[model samples]
Target: MSDLLIGGAETSTLAALASPVTVIDSTTSCQDVDELFRADEHLGCLAVHGDGPGRSLGLVSRVPFQHLMSGRLGYGKLLNTRRPVSALTDWSPLVVHAATGVAEVARQVLDRGSSQRFSEVLVADPGAPLRQVSVTDVFRALSGELATKALTDALTGLANRDHFLQRLQQCCTAPDVRRRLALVYVDLDGFKAFNDGHGHGVGDLVLQVVADRLRGCFHPGDLVARLGGDEFAAVVQLPAGVPVGPAARQLGERVRACLSGTISLSSIVLPGRASVGVAVASSVLADGETLLREADLAMYRAKAAGGGRVELVTDVGSTAPREQFAPDRRELQRAVDEGEFLVHYQPIVEVGTGRLASVEALVRWQHPRRGLLAPGAFLGAVADAGFAANLDLHVLEVALAQFSRWQRNLGRAAPRAVNVNVSVQGLLHPRLAPAVLDALSRAGLDPAVLRVELPEAATTTQLDVVRGALGTLRAAGVRLTLDDLGAGASSLHHLTRLTLDGVKIDRRFIAGLLDDERDAAVVVMLLELAHSTGIAVTAEGVETRPQLEALQEMARGRPTFVQGHLISRPVAAEEIALPWSGGLHHLHAHVPGPRSAVPTAPGPVASS
Candidate 1:
């Protein structure tokens, strides 16, 4: 290990540092292993591996181990001696392979969110026992190789693209931005032409010169980077209290001048110019990629209008590029990690006696800058991002967990079950059934208390997918319902082909069910279809007393449920307990009135 460290951390591979380590049985008691740490002060932690079936690995750090055993006033050593090591093991360690470059491993180790930055790392080598590597050893070698290899541009002596992006995320993510964060994107307008015309030597020199000028353009608090080739970017902090647009433009102009100014290459002067684009975030409600993209788009616009000028984008979301506004899978993944997604519940009540039927779970994205966003704003984007399956599972877990909480509090009074929507992609995901069942098992909740809703006409063409995913769920005593009944596909075909516990009359028909004959006809037909099929019916988007009265009049003694602004809009989990116990309470979310606070850039946004 010392030889590998001395040889050079960058060039050495992780395989070289791999050392055989003892693996503790996961079922071993803490008291039995207490003497292991006391006997060896140098032992940082021990690896614990479970037996067959659900064979999993974990790490028990000396600190947490000792703390747990010590107890208050140190009595836990005797009382908690028999506790299994698996109970206290950290299961989610960042695993790596032996063939991985030490530099890469170090970067992965240190690049995690600070809370998890120092989690355990196990080097898995084929034909060998899983060996553990101390994080302290990784940190010791960080100084020698990390600065030049991972962060700094070797040729230009500036922050590299990765480092620049990290800094930009930091600026955009700051809880309070003081409304002074901005991004500057610089593209050397004719550098490629000049580089191709000249040799590689001249091209390299030009890049170094551009890097130097960029350095001069940004200050001590700013981050400037060579985003590969001729493109460079900066995350700048403007002087507080000044207008962001003006200040950003002023800085952009300086960068333009600095790059286009004096460039004498071996007594031959070259026109070193750049198209500079500036985007200013007036508030903390900004996304790193969105801001960078805004600046990049502005730069392109400047280049299109003829080079060597600065383009500024002041209005963030409205005037910024439209592509960034759309939902992105990567953005959704980040939102899940950052916990920007939250669940809201709307009461579904029986129309006859106003008895609490169930609560449908609605997913909302709570943006740091925007109060809350409905499914209309980003669900399509999530689906487009190909994250529909993952997001659906995440939402299912959240809704199920919330239902468990309610069941804990209200006992019998809690809504009978939680109805959660599952997208078509999620319904097709192989892991859906097992994951849902596992969650229910872990929560000690009955599968009957969880109702998974599938869009009615969504999978008509793919009955195989429907059968494969829904079959296991149905067999487990889980209720399956069809949402937006007449919204898509063939309603009658679905009623006959699919085994549904209930069907939601599409919101479109209910919106004007009383006044529109065609809509009334559609609702009546849907009710007849569901009733004849022995499935319950839910009238969605029921807003007024007239609509409710009209629907109740049409009911032919079948189990009918209604949900919409009429009974109450969706509310937070804690606030939902009221409607559960009260049976017919109209719940509402007190939020600032309707406003489209679309992110100018993608930052923290929605989930399922």
Candidate 2:
């Protein structure tokens, strides 16, 4: 039996199936072991113990061991009854360490060939008792759990971004494929606002509803996936000889119509709309990223051109070259060197007393030809040019200097902290911690006076690297926050691992908080989560009195802060007005209701 077993040395001892094994002492006779196997018909194998307690000498299987002892051969009839069970034990049975990976165990099992494929494997430490595992259990768990996690979105139950890209790649690389493929990038226009207004509980339902609508808009063969947040993508095969442009346009129109109607959850009726961008595979060799980018660019164009519309990448009148939209690399570098960038500060006030708490530092580009442009217009270009870190450092330095100036003027009346947006690139930079500490030192400011805001979307990838850098920043006494929580692919999973000072709820939820039950519930949940963890919570985009009043009510017993136009818009450093400074109090007195007070200009600040 020992000689018949193969690859025993290579099998992982840890890979034993988590199942019960029948154990018998090595002193037990073959006939006794046979009787024990007969008593438990479902038992696949038994462990034969050696002289020491809990020490397994080897394993014996029901089938082969029984055949050897049945006296089928002349030798078996004469000697089987008296032979020790150890004679039938598989001494070289497949053994693996407990720490071995499942994949390696499966590979070793398959390598043993079909004869031992279903045989029980021993999972144990050397000199320890053996535990049995089933090969079928390993494959079933791997195929069921790993496969689902890899291919499906856990939230919406649709194909995930990874699965969608893989299928798109397959379609692009299919040999001699003649049919064209269309990629439609759909972004819900006001989803963030909807989520903010209603709450995450209802927001999740909205996403499911959108997913169902999207799934209905296309044929069963088409692939649809939520690319995080309000973004969704679909890849469909176009009929032979059908022009990509017309097919994409027609499909986008159908999707728009399908998603345009109102969705009713409980007693609340929420309106829905999406901006769709269509890109077709120009050739069978086209890359997935390029195709997706083209579609994304078109989606932006649709959004910029007053949203709720579909735009095709191939549309001559609507589509512009990608380079044209992105700022010139030299121009961006010149802006940094020439001091062409400016920082604007927006006040975050306590919901209870409306007292000034902190001001978030937002960046604006003073583009020579483009006038005073928000970061959105050119920050993407800066990021694409690999200057995101440099730009982030510049903003931080300026914000710290300005914060110092504010402290000089206000003395003890200054806001508690000034928040500067930190890009993921900046956080990961080797010099980030040193640079920040130096800035604070030069300004003679405490690390607690300056809070760094990191976008939630940015921290999802390369977490170890992000966490390492963040850990250094935290160690330096610098305050850190996850900005725009619940806006993109925000998850509570991040909150569990990273050390954070606070979380800023994105304005989208605030926009609907007053009238939306879902928004109210989500806000309360976030406040509870933050408060329970000893992390502060700030709500952004509080543009109305009703929203402000409602947030105040929700945050009655908690330490919550609010920021938006209703408090004050982002203004130049010199224009920052705190409640103690008479600026905030004056504005609050004049604004009677929502949309009643008009600001001189729209807020130019953008999230980092």
Candidate 3:
């Protein structure tokens, strides 16, 4: 189906097909209705209403109205041209609930009398006027999804073998000519052994984990799919004018890192590893099947070489050298010494007042070679290298100095507090609290004005160690809050053992606010929990007007703060207006694009 008919991904529902329609008075003349239809092609249909509050009388279609207006002769047209349209309207038009499924709506439309089967459907929702949805749109949406199920994996929801092959052929046949095509093929190692040892149920969970990791590691513009069983593939299009060698190598390295980690299952960790192979095809001359075979063979070579690494093959028959992706302790320390890190601030705004309540200082890697990298790209390596503590302290020092500068410049308008995030190593480190206090002291900033955010992973496992740091920071008048509230595996009930000043409701909850009732209930429960404790609540990752409105409604009368792209994206410290002048008039609910409904999984500052 075309975008105009389906509207967007939410097109499965009848409402996505609905174009807003106004209720015209029953006494509106046919002449006026004709003019309205002639003025706008979108006015394919209109609704008629009668009496006070306007109960729906009937619906009028352009074709039928035109037929009625012209009449059989000029005498008939002259007599009825100025008459009210309601007299000729179809009062018994099919009315459908806005929430009805497209397929079901299509079925209902087909069941109607033959004469009216092709007419527009009148979509009804409370407080909204009847909307005209075309019969053709209903069928088109149905066809698109039935075709989708044929090409999608029911387990991982990635494209199935057939779909992947189909798209690969399309890309190769046309050969973008500007972009080279490359495939990243993956095969799970020891999967059969793991299944026999842990049962297929556990094996299935492991496969799901691999699929999710692939999603996290690849760009959305790329295609990642399951080639059945334990094998998956990704088609990555190289940037225009960029050769396939370095581009494929970097992507392979990054993806390899994301896929190498162990899967944490209930009470047991599974050593889920894979052998990855990347094969490149030139833009000018290519064949999808040949590329697939090359990638597959490279993957076999990788598995033979002991698995868990990325190998690349090109048509030129050259293979990139095999190198591991782990960041060493010395290398991490070198990053610190070289001053290759910077900070971006994401503001938390007061709901109704729109005032910037506080700002979260998120760390970014200003890599000389990699441009600005999100924390997700490097924090895991930092953890592996045992340098999370050093990175945490550096970010703290930089955040404090900038915050002190802001206080000096804005005076009373500066934010009330600044929040800094901590990783597992940092949260458990004995020196974290002292370092924070020292940094605040050096910057002449109040400890109370600094908020330390603890990632969920840090507290779920190392509660006792975290408790000690929590005690020191709390006693020093520094605030402490739990970040990414539902992201970890531990029960929230266990968190009672630690002291917390507030919680940042995870982006997952905020993303699903409008579509999922369970998500909404969880958010409400979290809000109520914070309200009862007399602590603050920060709903993070708000991206749309509907989402913001929903959170505002749910957190009503409570001291809640909202943050995300809709308020202001993570920006350099110099970009925020102190006092958030005029309540950030420039930033209110201005979402970026069609995909803003579910924001790109934000890599929170250092989610190590």
- Candidate number achieving the greatest lDDT relative to the actual structure: 3
Candidate 2 lDDT by residue in tens digits, 202-240:
998898888888767777667788888889998776776
Runs off by more than 4 Å, candidate 1: 1-320, 326-328, 369-371, 577-608
Leading candidate by TM-score = 2
Residue clash pairs of candidate 3: none
TM-score for each of the candidates: 0.45, 0.55, 0.50
How well is each residue in 1-608 modelled by candidate 1, as lDDT tens digits?
00100111124466666566668998898877788889999777788887655458777778778887898998979777888878777776677988776546755664455555565578887898888777656534432342333355656767766567756766665756526777789998877877888877888888888777776666756777888888988877778777777788788988998988767899656787889999877563446777888899999999999999999987565444334455577778888888777787777788776777888887887766655777756676688789888878778788888888777887876788888888878877778889889989887899998888886536567656658768888999999887776554354456667877888877766865775444564566566556655788998877777788788887855678888766766666765544343333342331121111222223221113
Candidate 2: worst 10 consecutive residues by lDDT? 1-10
Q: Compute the lDDT for candidate 2.
A: 0.71
Candidate 1 local accuracy as lDDT?
Answer: 0.71
Cα RMSD (Å) between model 3 and the true structure? 22.1
On residues 63-141, what C-alpha lDDT tens digit does candidate 3 reach at each position?
8877877778756457676788777788778888999876567556645676777788989998987687887677556
lDDT values of the candidates? 0.71, 0.71, 0.74
Worst 10 residues of 1 by lDDT: 1-10
